[model samples]
Target: MRPVPLVLPLAGLPHRVPGDTDAVVVGGGVAGISAAVVLAERGVRVTMVEAADTLGGRLGAWPHTLPDGTRQIVEHGFHAFFRQYYTWRAILRRADPALGFLRPVVGYPVISRRWPDEDLTGLPAAPPLSLLALFVRSPSLGLRDITGADRSLALELLGYHRERSTPALDAMPAGKFLDRFGITERARSMLFEAFARSFFCDPDALSAAELVAMFHFYFLGNPEGLGFDAPDTDYLSCIWTPLADHLTRHGGRIRAGAAADTVEPADDHRWRVRVAGGAQVTARHLVLALDPAGLRGLAERSPGLRRVGPALAERAAGLRVAPPFAVSRLWLDRDVAPGRATFSAVTGEPTLDSVTCYHRLEEPSRRWAATTGGSVLELHSYACVEPDAAQATARMRDELAALWPETRDAVVRHQLCRYEATAPSFPPGAAGARPTVQTDARGVRVAGDFVELPWCAGLMERSAMSGILAANEVLAEEGAAAEPVHGVPQRGLLAGWTPMTRRRR
Candidate 1:
C-alpha cells in the first residue's frame, strides 16, 4: 500500500552538507513543522520551538479516559482534509507513504431538521453539471429560484477568475453581493451561509472576494470533487506524531514546552531566539510561524521583534481575529440509526453548524461503540452566538435531541466542550491587508493561515503553504532553488474577462 517517497528535484543546488545552515522555526504547528522538515531535508539544521508541551498548536489533541479506563486522544473539533490539499498531502506522504491514515467521507451533506430528507448529497462532481444537478435535485432550490437571481452575477458564479474578478469583489461584503444577485433566501441559508460559517465568519461580514475565491478553490478549480477526508484515528497519532518523527529523523530538533520570548539579530548577523526557560537557540535564519494572536503577542512583548521595525509591529496589531468558535463531544448511551450519515452539516440551528457520528466514521470509535452499545458524537459551532460554553453546549444538546430522538433518553456518559478565538477573519477589504510570507526584515519570515499566499488555499493547506514559502525564501537567499508549491487554478473561461478587459472591447 506504500507509495515510493517522492524526492524534491532542486536544480543547480546540491543539497548542503548537514549542519552547514541553521534555522530556528518559532511554533511547532503544521507550518513550523513543515518548514523544519523541508529545511532538514535540504541538510539544514532546524530547531523548532513549541509553547505547548506537545506539537500541533490548534490541531493538537489530548488523551481522555472513558469510564472503563479506555483512553482516547480528543481533538478540538472535526478537521476536513479536502483532496485539493496538494502541499499538505505531499508532507503527509513523506511521513506515511501509504497515506492510510485518511478515510474519505463520501459526499458533502448539508442536513436540515425542518425537512429531514432535504440533505444535499450525490450531486455531480464536475461543475456546470454539478451546479445544474444541485439546483435540480435539491429540495431547497428550484428552476424558479435560479430565475430570481441576478443574471450577470449568477452567470459569473460558474466562471470566477481570481486575479480579474476578485479585486472588485473584495470591495463589497458577501451579503451585499448576494443581494445584487438576488439569490434566494433558501439558497443563502442552506448553501452560502453554511460555507461562510465554515470560515467562522458571518456572511454579511465576509468579503465577497473571499467567498468567490473559496468557491473557486473548493469547487471550480479543484480537480478532486467536493468530498473530504478525515483521519482514520486521532490526529495526535496519525498526523502530528508522525510529522514529529519525520522532523527528528531528518536531523531537526523539536523542543516542546519551549516558549520563545525574543528573537533578535546577534552581532554575528545570526538570529538569536531565547525561550522562556532561559534556553537560547542561535541560527542564521528565523521563521516566525506563529498564529495571528501569537504574532501579535510577540510584536508587543518581544523587544527583539521591535527591531524589525514599527511597521511590522503595526501590521501585526492590525490583523483581525475571527469570533470565537466552539466544539462539543458527547458520549451517548445509545446508537444513532444505521441510516444516519457519518458527517452532516446542520441548518435551522442557532449555534450548531455540523455534526459527526465518530463511532460510524472512525474505526476506534466503532469498536468502542460495539462494546458499549452506544455512540460518540461530536458537534461543532462556528462564530457561536452563545455567550458561554455552558449555554452553547446546552443548546447543542437540545438540538441533537430534537434531530435524533434516541439521544433524548440516552444518558450522557462523558462530555467535553471547548471554545477558542483563533480563526483568521476575512472581512470586506481584508485580503489586501494580510501579511505575506516574506518580510522586509532580514533573517525573519512569517507563516500562518492568515498570511497572504500567491496561490489560493485556506485553513491547514494555507498554513502548510505559507510554511513552505517561508522556507523557500530562506533557501532562495542562500542561492539554492526554491521548493515547488502547488495551487488550484481560479481563472475559468467566463471569468477570464475583467471589467477593464470588457471595457476595452
Candidate 2:
C-alpha cells in the first residue's frame, strides 16, 4: 500500500521555463495555489486571482473577534489531512518543508447515540490485513452480520478496480448499493452511512461507484492507513501566509479579492480575464481552477470558449454543486467530560454529522481556552436540510448535547455559523462529465476537486493532483520538466478476483 510514483521528474530538462512564459490561475484554493507554486518555481510568471478576500476556498479561514475582544481565526469546517495524501503533502512541503504545523490527531472514532463509539484508527496499514482487522475488531460488524449479508456483494468492497467498479456501480445510488449488501442496520448506519456523508451528500443521492472508490482510496488501498493530522495553528498563519510567501519568493503574485467576471479569448495566443473592478489580466497560459458553479458561470459568460473548448464549456454547463453544508463554531463556557476525542464522526443524526473540540486540536484554541476557562467546539453538517445557518447551528448544538449530556447545559460564549453549497456533488452517472486538467482549448486547463482525474484521489488530495497535472500540461507545452506526482495503489488487493456471483448456476 505504499505510494507508487506515477509521474517522475525527467532528466536532461531545464529547471525553469524560458522568459515571457506566464500563467494566470483563476482560483487560489489548494488547486489554484498548487498550480501556481509549481508554475512559479519553474520561472513561469504566475498570477493567481482569488475571488475571496482570503485564500484556502472551502478550507479558508479569516480573522474574527469574539464578544470578549479575543481574536480568533475561524474556518469553513474541519478537514483531516490523511497521511496517504502524498501529493498534497508534497505541495504543503513548499510552505513548511518539515510540515511542522500538522499534528497527529489521536483515534478517529465514529460516535452515535445508538451504539458505543466505533474506533477506525490504528488498524493494519495495508488492505486485506487492514480490512481483516476492521472485521475482526469492529463490534459494529461481526460474524453474524456477514453470514446474514450477501457475501458476494460485500466482497466487491475489497475488489475495487476502476475499470470494473466504475462501470458496474456508477449508475446506482450509494444507499441502494449499501442496502443490497444486506448488512445489519447498525453496521450500515455506523460504518457506511456515517462515512458517506463526509462527501457532502446523502448516500441516496451519491453514486455507488464513488462510495466504492472512496472505500478503496481511504481504507482498503491506502498504504498509510486511516490515521490523519491537522494543523497546530490557524490556516492563515500556518498554511496561507507561508504558502503565499513561498509563491511570491518564486516571483508569483496572489491577487485576493479580485473576482474574475468573464474569460475571453485574447489576442496573441493569450486569455483575457476580466476582474470585478474593470481590471483585466491577459496571459499565455490560463488555468481555470474554480468551484463548480464558478466555472459554469464563467464558461457561460465566455461565448467564444465554445469554439476553442466545446467539451469544457459543455461540461461546465452540466457540472452540479453538492447540497449546502453548515459549520458552527462555538465558544462554550465549559468543557465536555474528559476523554472526548478531538474529532468525532457522528451518525444516525437528523442534522449533525461531526464535532471537533478545537481547543484540543489547535494551539490558538487551546490558548483561548486557557485564558477564558472555556472550550472551542465546532459542529459540521455535510448535507444540511435546515433552511438557514442559525437554525442549522441550533439543531447541531441540540444533537451534540443529546450525544454528550454535559454539553446540554454549556453556555455558548460566541458562535460563528457558516452555510454554503460549494462542494461538488457526485450524483449517479456523473463519472466523466467533469472536465480534466487539460482541456480542448489550446492553452486553457482546469484544476479543481470536481475536475475528472485518471488516478484515484479524494478531497484535498484530488485538488492538489489536478493542479499538479494541469501545471504538468503547461510544462509539457513549454518543453520543461514536469513535477513528479505520486499515487496510491490504483486497484484493491482483490481487484482481479471476484467472489461467487448470485446469478444463475
Candidate 3:
C-alpha cells in the first residue's frame, strides 16, 4: 500500500515564475529536496538553493566510518523510526532493498550491570504483551500498582485525545507522565530514559504531551514496527545525495556557500532572494524552508516585512527543539562482540542513550558492532546535560573511559559532532500548532518536518513529505497536475484523535 496521503497546502502563492518555472525552494535539506523532486516529477521547473555545500542538514554528517575501517552507520545522534514512519520507509524502499527492516522482539531494552531477576528472553506477540513482559521483567516497577492501575493508564495514553478531558498537557514535566502512569522507576530509567535521551533533552524539561505522542508513535503503534527494524541505507545516500544529484541532473542550479542574506518582495509579489556571496536569484514564489529563527536577521532588511518577520520569529523561538547534543566516535583496535542493534543498558545515569552497532546492522564482515578498530563506535549523549562544545567533548572522552577503560589504550582515532536544536519536541498539539506552509503574507511558503509531520518528524522522510506537500500545493495553484493525494477529510480509523481530520477547508 502507498503511504497515507499527507499534503500540507502551500496555498496563497502568486504565480509569476518569469519563465515556466513554478517555485524556488530555499534550504537544501530533505524538505527542500523533497519539494523540488516532487515538483520536477510533476513537470515544474524548480530551483533549490542550499546554504551549505551539502544537503541533509543533520542527516548529512552521519554513518561515520571507523578506525578499523569498519563502518558503524550511526546517525549523528541515535535516531531510528517506527514502521509508521511511512515517508521514511517509502524513500528507503525506493532507494535500496538491502537496507532491510526488522521488528524487535522486545520493546525497549532493560539493561543493568547485573542480570535481572526475571529474564525476558521470549518475545511477546504484540504491544500489550510486550508491555506486560516489560513490566514483569523490569526491576523498578511496583508490582501491585502496575498490575492494578498501569493497564488503565496505558490504555488512556494509547487512546489519548485532546478533547478527552485528560489533563496530561498541563503536566509539563515528562516525569509526571511516568509517575501518573505508575511506571516503575526501572521502566522510567530504562525505557523512558532512552526515549528522552533520543530527544537529547531532559525528562523534566520535555512536555508531557510531546512525550506521550512520541511514546505512542514509537512504542505502541503497529504492534511490531515501532521498535522493530528494517535494514536501511544511511539517510545521506538514500535521501540527500539522490536529491542533489537529481537537481543537478535536471539542469537545476544549486550554489553552495550562498547563504540567503535577505528576502525582498518585488513590485508584483515576486521574491528577490539575496545570497551571502552570490547574485540575487529572483523567483515568483519563495520557500523559506529554514527554521524561523534562522531567518530573523534576513527579514530585518526588507520593508513591510519587519512585523511579519518577528511573528515568524516567535514561531521559531517558541518551538522548543531538543537541545544540542554531542555524537562521539571511537575507533577500536579489535572487533566488537556481535549482537542486534541495542537500546539496552539500564543504568543509574545513562551516559549513552541508545546504542546501535551499525557494523552489525549494516555489515556482518566489519567484525565490530558499536565498536570498530579499523572501525567506529558511536555514542550519543544528551544535549541538555552538555550544551557547550567544550563540555560535550570532554564528557564524551570521559564516557569512553568509563565504558571501556581498557579500550582507551587501543583507541585508533576519535571524532565529535554536535548538532544544536536538532529536533523539536513533537507532542500532539504541536502538530496543530505548527505554522502553516503558507503564511499570511505574499510570495512566501514554509516547508519542514516541523510543518508537515510535526510529531517526531525529524528524519529525511518527514522533511521530504513536507517539501512535497508544499511543492504540490504551489504547482496545483499554477495549474499543474497535482499528483499528491491529500488526506481524506472523512474520518476513518483513529481519525477521532486528529483535529486536522475533523476540519475541512
Instruction: Point out where model 2 deviates above 4 Å.
Output: 499-505
lDDT-wise, the better of 2 and 3 is 2
lDDT of 2 by residue, 373-482 (tens): 98999999999999999999999999999999999999998999999999999999999888888889989999999998988898899999999999999998898899
Please tell me which model should have the higher lDDT, number 1 or number 2. Answer: 2
lDDT of each: 0.79, 0.91, 0.54
> Whole-model lDDT, candidate 3?
0.54
- Per residue, candidate 3 scores C-alpha lDDT tens digits across 1-505 of 1233544434554333223655677787667766666666555666777776666666553455654475544444435555455555544444444434333334345444433422333435345555556567556554754653455445645554433312436345776667766765655665676566565567766667656555554444333333445334455555556656766666566766677877776665577787887578887777777644454444555554545444554454455565666666554455444443244432444355434444444443234533334444565666446656656655655654554455355554555556366565554344455556766656577777666342333344456666766775667667654434332111112424433223321
Misplaced by over 4 Å in model 1 are: 1-10, 15-19, 116-125, 498-505
Which of the two candidates, 1 or 3, achieves a greater lDDT against the reference? 1
lDDT of 1 by residue, 295-337 (tens): 8887778776676655676678788898988899888888988
Evaluated against the true structure, the overall lDDT of model 1 is: 0.79
Candidate 1, residue 188: how far the Cα is off, in Å: 1.3
Model 1, position 6: C-alpha lDDT score = 24
Q: What's the TM-score of every candidate structure? A: 0.93, 0.98, 0.77
